[model samples]
Target: MIDKIKRIVEPVVQDFNAELVGVTLKGAKRNYILIVFVDRIGGVTIEDCTKISRQLSKEQELDDLLGNNYRLEVSSPGMDRPLKTPQDFKRNVGRFLEIEFEDKAGLHKLK
Candidate 1:
């Protein structure tokens, strides 16, 4: 479902020059919540989120993709969001970071 959402949402997001960071769907059949995370080089703004939301809601395919009873949210992943991919790390270069991982020794961290 997430893959489908990404496939459907990616182009619409890029039309505004934003990257779709992630998507999550939750809740029962009647109250599904779809959260989309968007980002770009200069960061995203409320207007960006607003535009994305409007565009996404205007997509007929998305309506059929998720059925008729769901709410969509568009927003940034927020400050202190964990960096997951090589590209994510690369994009955040020179910014302070906190990394924590677990191993046989229990846990380790790098700042």
Candidate 2:
């Protein structure tokens, strides 16, 4: 479902020179919410979010893919969000970060 949505929205996002970081769908069957996280070399702004949201909202492909029951949100993955992918790491090449994780096997437990 997410992949299908990405296919529709990714190009629109890129049209504005932004990266489609991630997409998430949440809530019940008939009441779904779609959130699109976007970023770029200089970061994201409210205008960027608004433009993407408006453009995506106007897409017939989105309506065809998701129907009219879902809500679409476009925004940036802010500072508190964790960097979980190589691409994410690449974007923050020189920025300092606070890392947190759990050892799945408990082999190197910190506490």
Candidate 3:
């Protein structure tokens, strides 16, 4: 169900020239919390968050997708942009990154 929601929501964001970096669901007690992360060229503003949140809330409610009670948060990916997939690494090849790698020893840079 969550994956379906992500799929439906991601493209909608992409249509607005924003990249859907990730989606997270936290807090199990109250159904769940949905956080959608989008990235636009010049960074996101509070208005962007409000607009996406409003639209997503309506869609989730109309489809009854998030159960009866849940919090839906839509905003730009934070300073810690989620590294959700291998593609994230490839896409950010030249960008500065900080990560804890398992079975890794020293710091290395990708050219």
RMSD values for the candidates in order, in angstroms, are 2.1, 3.5, 4.1
Q: Each candidate's lDDT (Cα)?
A: 0.89, 0.86, 0.71
lDDT for each residue of candidate 3 in 15-101, tens digit (9 for 90 to 100)? 666778778888775578888887665666788777777777667542576676888788866666657777566556666777654
Model 2 weakest 10-residue run by lDDT: 102-111
lDDT comparison, 1 vs 2, better candidate: 1
Report the number of clashing residue pairs per model. 0, 0, 0
Q: What value of lDDT does candidate 1 attain over all alpha carbons?
A: 0.89
The regions of model 2 sitting more than 4 angstroms off are 101-111
- Tens digit of per-residue lDDT, candidate 2, span 60-90: 9878777778899999998878778887887
**Error of model 1, residue 42, in angstroms:** 1.9
Per-residue lDDT over 1-111 for candidate 1, one digit per residue giving the tens place of the 0 to 100 score: 789889999999999999989999999777889999998876889999999999999988878977888999999888778888886766677767788899998999988
Task: Provide the TM-score for each candidate, comma-separated.
Answer: 0.83, 0.80, 0.65
Task: State the lDDT at 34 in candidate 1.
Answer: 93
Candidates 2 and 3, the one with greater lDDT: 2
